[model samples]
Structures are given as C-alpha cells and as structure tokens.
Target: MTELMRTTSATLSRLWTGSARHLTDDELTAVATGETVAQRTLAHLDQCQRCASSLVHAADAIDLLQEEASASFDKAYTTERHQAQRRRIGRRLATLVGTESPGKVIHFPFSGRPLPQLSARSGHWIAVASAASLVIGVSAGQLLHFHAAPAKPISSDGVAVTESAQTVPLTFDMTGTVKLPLLGDGLQHPAGEWSSLTLEEFDELMGNPAFFGNDDLALTNFLMSEFGSIDALTPHVSDLPVNIQ
Candidate 1:
C-alpha cells in the first residue's frame, strides 16, 4: 500500500481503539475521504466487533462533549451581550435626565459663541496706548499753561524815588597810615586826613550817575562842603536811607 494509505489506516485504527488522544474535525474528515484505503478500513472495522463498538462509543462521546461546550459558550455570550446593553441604556437615560433638568449650561468661551463683545473690545496694546496718550496730553497741557503766562517785572519805584536816596555815609577809621582816594580831588590822600565831600563828589566816587545832574565838577565842590569825606557821605546816597549827611 501507499504511505498515505498506511498513515490513514493507522490513524483510523487508533481512533477506533480509543488510543488516539483527540482528532480535530479537519483530521477526522481527511481520514474519512472516499478512497479505497478509508473504505477498506471502515469495512474491516464493521466486520470486527471490538473495533466497531469502540468507534461508535468514541464518536458518541465526542459529539456529546462538543454539544455541551457549545451550549455553555452560547449562554455566556448571551449574558455578556445583555449586560452590555443594560449599561448602555443606563448611560443614555442618565444623559437625558441631566439635559432635562435645570442645570447650568457650560459652554467653551472661545468655541461656542461668536464673542461679539470681546471682539468689539480693544486689545491690550491699544488700551495701554490710549492711557499713555491721555496722560501725555494732560502733561503737555499743564506745561503749555505754565510757559504761556508772562512773568511779573520787579518794581523800580522803591529804588527810583529821590527822597528815599538820602542816607548816612560809611567811614572806615584806619589804625595805621593808609592812602585813601580824595573826595573832590582826582588823587588819593593819607589816612586820618579828613576830606569833606558834597553829595555830587560822593556820587562820583561811588559811581552813581543819578547824583550830579549836568555840571558834575561844580556839583562835586558844592557836595564836598555839604558832606564830609567821600567815605562819610556814601551812606547818605541810596534808594532809601534812614540818616542823612
């Protein structure tokens, strides 16, 4: 016989003797091919009482075991599907109830609405610039107001009055011999040597032009007799003096 025929016969014999552990449906079908080797093996088994009885028993046992396992798996699958359906229905009911209640509506600020108000509002940079401009305008206005106004002039009435010009003279008594400028003469004199001066001489030596009106030399001689030395008559000629020469 061929090797395939030998192998098929050996496998069929093992199944009949119950020595074969198990055979998948494909293996069993392959051994049951409508070939002469499989037909001969079946004919042999039917004639032999022991092998035929064992084959019948094995087939019955395998069918019963497969039927039991299939029923159990179907029951478990049905139970799991029912449980999943119940959970899904419960979640749907919860969602419906929450939507029907008076709950606060939560919307994403940037996603849901058109944001008309925010879009109309000024941006941060624009707001800052506006505030800065307002401050700058106010500061500029204050500076302009301060600078536009004129300053008040000082009054000359107090110093320009002729009556207020009369004043006491200042004299420095030198301890040692010192040469001093003469009152009427155009030269200096020795210290402690008195030289009487008039108001004109006092004004000329003091560099005040308002003293001698027209003839400064004539006024100098007249002022020399009226006043003492140049230093003594200096105080009498001022904007405002309490004492006179």
Candidate 2:
C-alpha cells in the first residue's frame, strides 16, 4: 500500500496540469492484480472520485465472486481456479482495449451524386405549352360568352316577361275563298254568318233541301227508311192489336 501511494503521487506530480481521465479496464485490472501500469492511470485513479469509486466497486465484486467460487469448489482446486479466473479476466481486459464502438454514418440528399438538371430547350418548350394553354382557355371562355342566350326582360314585379301581355290583332285576307267562322274569343272578324246561326238552322242549311224537299212527306219517308216504323217509335196503344178471346 505504501509503494502504491508513492507511485500514485509520482503520477500526480508528472501529470497535474489538466483534468484527470477515467481508468480503462486494463488499468483497473493492473491495479486489482498488483501489476505495473502507466503513471497516468494511477494519477487519474487518485484524483478522479468517480474512477476511484468504480475501482472500489470492481474490487468488491471480484472479491464476492472469489468467495462464491471458493465455497463451491474444494480447497485442493483453489490455486488452479484462482489462476484460471485471473487469466480469463486478463483476456477480457485485453479484448475490451482492442474493441472499438460502432459509429453511425448519415448520408443526406445531394451529399453524393449531383441531381440531373432540366435543359434550356426543354424549359422553353414547357413555357410555350403553358402560354398556349392559357390563350386557348381565354379564347374558349370568350366564345362561350358570345354564344350564350340573351336574358329576357324583367318586369316591375321581379318576374321575367317573355312576351307582351296585351293581345295582338291578327288579320288574314280570304276575299276570293270561302271562310268558316266560329264563336267565342278566337276570331274577332268572322267572314260568314255561320256564328250567328243556331244548331237547327245550321243543320237545315247543310242538308240537301232540293233532293229531299221541305215538305213533311219526304222527311217522313226518309225517317221511316232510316228507322223501322213510326208506330214502333211512337208506341201508340191504339196501334197494338187487341186479342179478344
């Protein structure tokens, strides 16, 4: 312990300029097994409270492991077991020194190969196409507006008046040809006296009066020929034959 303190003081005297660093596994192992180590390791162990605490913890854990191992094994195998454990610990310490931590390598966009650029000719063509499309759209809009139907005039009541409400006098000439007239609102100027005639008078006018004369005999014959007999139509009780039994 006195020699350890002297070595530690000598290390501190040599490297007392800056902050002390943490001890590596090899340095810690050397300290634990009483092997010669760098003076800086000893100096750091003396100055750094965290490293000193870690060394103490490691020593306690090793002692606990040895105690547990001795309890499981016989006294005859004690020396061999201790030697083997030390050898294993040394090999592990050496591996820890040689091993390096993996690092992350990030690759950002545009960090490697350059991006392909658009050519001047392609850009000019794209602009020309865009301008043509704009002009075509404008012309189409104007053409649609020109072809649209005009709006009907609106009245004072906020309703659209498609045609005039007042009636228009319609006239047609039928000087040389015959014209048939009808009653009611449609014809204001009737050509013939057909509207003034009653239904009976119209029927009389349309009938062939010269062929079937105005006398009642001709009418009776016509009626009898069309219908069966006047007796059957009139159904007089006097015409019925009496059966006197």
Candidate 3:
C-alpha cells in the first residue's frame, strides 16, 4: 500500500511541474524531510500554481485516510458483537419455551401435505353440473310415473276424461266418420224414449213415433226383402222369415 502511495505521489509531482522531466532525487528528499531546499527549487515551486493545488488535494486525502483508519471495525470486534447478539436471541427464546438456552438452531419435523385447490371457473362448472343432474333426476322420475300409471276406463255416453284432458279419444285418422248406437231394445229400454238402461239406445230412438212416423215400418219391409234376395242367391242357412205384413 505504501508503494502505491509513492507511485501516486510521483505522478502528481510530474503534473505540477508541467513537464515530463522528473524531480531530482535530492529535491524529492528535501520535500519529504521538510528541509530547506535549493533556491532554484524554491523558486520553481513558488511559480507553479498546479503543484500548489496538487499538494493541497494530497493533504486533504491523507486526513480522510487517517479518520477512516481510526473508525475501522476489526475482526475481533466483529466476532464479539456477533456472539453478543446470539446470546440475546437465545435468552429471549428460552423465556418463551421455559427451557434453558440450547445455544444452537432447532430443527422442526412438521410434515408438508398438499391439498387440491379449486379455481373460480372450476367451482362454477361443478355447481352447474350438480344442478343439471338434479333436473335430470326429477324429469326421469316424472317420466317413469307417467309410464306406470293405469289406463282410465271410458264411460259410454257421459263426459269422459282422456289423456289430453279432453272428452274425445285421441286418434290419428280424421278421414272417416263413426256410427254410435242411440236406440234401445224393448227388454233394456222402453220403445218411446232415450234411456241409460239400454245397451242399444239407437234401436229405441228409431222405434219412437215422434221421431220416425211410418218410416220404421217401411224400413222393416225393405230389410226383409233384401235378405230374401241375398238368401236365394247364397242358398245358405234357413231362408229369412217373410212376415213383413
């Protein structure tokens, strides 16, 4: 370190001289020892402002170096400080644990377990799926109940309840007309009026004089003659009786 300082001193001296030529060894020694120098060297130094400024800067730098050296923390001081800190920490730890200071770091044995985390989007999908499943289950149950229900019996003439909540039966074809019996036989219903007692109400309706007049007698004769003709042609079971008179 002293060698480096000497080298810097020389370079600064040359800059102050304003020339590359170095100072004589005697002149350098005189300056170092603070002895009176030659009249020529003294005159030179007096005339050189650069050399004067350089010397003043060098003096300030030396003073800063002395202060730093005085303030330095040595290895022994550092070790002692660290040891004091450790003791203080241990005392605090001991107070907390109600135990003597172990003078060393303690190792814990806690196990590290990982659990699954659900993000906002994943949680939304799960909720949606659960709701959908519930709806599907309810719909399936309703469908099964509908399939297992018994058929409702149809009442012949009274208001009838049907699958579509209508009085009429549901049918695909609408092209043909249906014929229903509105008359009744004598045993089941009186000949003059409509009755619930008859299985054949259409026959009783046709026998009524208010509705049929003489047309029923003419229809009976026509039916008998047509049967006679059909029987003569087929030569089948005994001929239809001819008692139309």
Candidate 4:
C-alpha cells in the first residue's frame, strides 16, 4: 500500500512538472480513451496542485479521479464537448484536403478565317518584299522626273525644228483601282518622285550651296535645328549619296 502510494505520488509529481500544464490534443484524446499512460498521468494530476488548477479551467465540473468509472455524468459531459470540437475541426480539415478541380480544355472561337495566317518567316519575307517594291517604285519615279524634257526643241542655229518626244505610258498593277474624277487625266505624272533620291544624295543636297551653306558647321546646325539632334541625322545620312557608307 505504501509502495502503491509512493508510485502514484512520483507519477503525479512527474506529470505536474512535465506535460500536465499544457496537454496536447493527442494526450487529451488518450485521456478520453482511458489509455494506461493517460490514466497514470491523471492519477499524478489528481495529487498535483498545478494539474488540478489547470483541470478546473479545462473542464470545470468534471470530477478528477484516480480509478476509472462507468460513464460518470461530469466525465461524459467533458468528453462530449471535447469530441464535438475535435469532430468540427476534423470536418473542416477534410473539406480543405478533399477539394480538387477537374482539368480544363481551352477552345479558340475564331480559328477558321478567310485571311491567310502568317508565320515569322512569312512576315519577314513580306516586309522585305514591301520594302523592295517601295524602293523600285521610287527609283522609277525619280528616273522619270530627272529625265523629263520639253515637248519642242530650241536649236543653237536658230532653226525651227519639229520634234515629237516619245512618251512611255506608266501602268501600275495594284490590288484595287479607284479613278478620282479630278486626277484621272492621262497626262498626269505618277506620285513619289523625290522618294527615289538615296540617303547620300538627300544629305548632300540638304548641305549643298543651293540649299543650306556647303560648310559642315552650317549643315550640322541646320540638321540639328530641323531634326532636334545629330543622332536623328545619322539615319537620314545613310540615305544620302555622299554618306551611303
């Protein structure tokens, strides 16, 4: 009997110093299930002031007992509250863990169309072709403008000469044609004549004696004033005849 009392006292002392202050959820469950570890722990707790105080706060009306009883009213009430709380938490955890979505399939609404789709390579080729056509059209217009001549000739010997100048009809093959009533005259020159001048020729002409002064300083200042900066002039210089390199 003395040994039993000493063993029970030592166990209670250990519980009071160790896990009694803050019992884990597992420990509380173990206590609910009447496990030997939990029973021994409770026996120690009954004798311990700190465990007894904590127990009062944990379950106010439940009678602390060293031996198991068959469904005591206080114990049943305490167990029911704890089990309800655990079940609520368990249900929440299950809802969180069980939520999963199905895989999705994406559909394009306007995949099929009359317009041809262009790849990167096709786009690049188109840009190159457009640039080439622009260059060619400009070159042809400039050629016509620089070579334009008067219909009649005035000779040095003061002779009246009847000369008919040969004219080549300009024809453009385009996707669509719209004839403007005012501009539909057959003798009108095609547009974009000055567009044929290369970057080098443009720069040289801009700096020529006929335009700005032929001095480098005057040309640089004029270009900077017109274009905002010297860097802006570099791209146009490459288009000029003298600065093609």
Please identify which of the two predictions, 1 or 3, would achieve the higher TM-score against the true structure: 3
Residue pairs with colliding backbones in model 2 are none
- Output the number of the TM-score-best candidate: 2
Candidate 1 residue spans exceeding 4 A from truth: 1-37, 79-245
Query: In model 2, where do residues sit more than 4 Å from their true spots?
Result: 1-33, 37-60, 63-117, 164-245
C-alpha TM-scores of all predictions = 0.21, 0.26, 0.22, 0.25
Estimate the lDDT of model 1.
Answer: 0.52
lDDT of 3 by residue, 1-245 (tens): 99999999977876665444434656655654568866556555566665545545655666787777766846346877989999898899887897874556654554344556789999999999999999999999999989995655343321223332233232323323223323335686553342232323434544565554344334333546555434223211011111111
lDDT of 4 by residue, 85-108 (tens): 997777777767875333345647
Candidate 4 — which residues are off by over 4 angstroms?
1-36, 59-109, 114-128, 133-245
Off by over 4 Å in 3: 1-49, 72-163, 166-168, 171-245
The alpha-carbon deviation from the true structure for residue 19 of candidate 3, after best TM-score superposition, in angstroms, is 6.6
Residues 1-245, model 1: lDDT tens digits: 69999999988987786545443344344444423434545555655566556556667776788899999989878977989999778777877888444445787777775655554345776798999999999999999989994542222421122321333234434332222222333456543344445555544556865543344334333545453334232322223222214
lDDT of 1 at 137: 100
Write down the TM-score for model 3.
0.22
Clashing pairs for model 4 are: 12-44, 198-239, 199-239, 199-240, 200-239, 200-240, 200-241, 201-240, 201-241
lDDT at residue 47 of model 1 (Cα atoms): 58
lDDT ranking of the models: 2, 1, 3, 4
81 Cα displacement, candidate 1 (Å): 1.9
